[model samples]
Target: MSELTPLDKAEAAAKEAATDTVAVQLALAAVELAKAATAQQPAHSPACSHQHKPGRSTGEWLAIGCAVCVGGVGIAFASIAIAIGGISVAILAVVLRSLWRDYQRDVQKGR
Candidate 1:
């Protein structure tokens, strides 16, 4: 690689300084533009002046309550149905087991 002379080093430093100056000027211009844009806008817009209620209305609350009650009743009925189905399966298994035992006993007796 060729060694840089004093003149070449000075030129390189000047070029870097010019680039940094241009970047700073661009940043200041952007900041001024943002300030001017905000100055032209109203502090409180018309939409922001209106009153707002964050909570739900009475009718909405009543509807939600009714939905919860209906869901609870539906769950209770489903639980009852599942319990009845399980009991029915258990009774069937017991009856089949008793029949199988009687059949084995008869076979052993030569019936």
Candidate 2:
């Protein structure tokens, strides 16, 4: 049988340590994300909010813009005119799109 050299053993040990470090990091991240998701009481009202990661998805901006735009339209229609069911439809589309974008980003970022 062949014996391993000191450097070879050290390399193997380092590789094992790297694996363990990655696993631990992954676990910690999952815990933090779960905590973030479940911690907040969803703000007291619409005026409250939060920030995003440094890098946000394209769809995130689209969703945010659509939500604001269509939401305004809906209110305009509700309080003023009545022929713009399209505004309600836009709101729904934006909501669904934002949800889908968030889900995709979370999955990709492994959180």
TM-score top scorer:
1
Cα lDDT tens digits for candidate 1, 5-58: 999999999988987797878988999999999999988778666788799989
- What digit string (tens of lDDT, one per residue) describes model 2 on residues 33-89? 999987875655566378745987899999999999999998987875554666888
What's every prediction's RMSD, in angstroms? Answer: 8.6, 32.9
Compute each candidate's TM-score over C-alphas. Answer: 0.59, 0.25
Against the hidden true structure, what lDDT does model 2 obtain? 0.86
Best by lDDT: 1
Off by over 4 Å in 2: 1-82
lDDT of 2 at 92: 92
Instruction: Give me the runs in candidate 1 sitting further than 4 Å from their true place.
Output: 1-28, 46-55
Worst 10 residues of 2 by lDDT: 40-49
Clashes found in each candidate (C-alpha, N, C closer than 3 A): 0, 0
The alpha-carbon lDDT assigned to residue 68 of candidate 2 equals 100
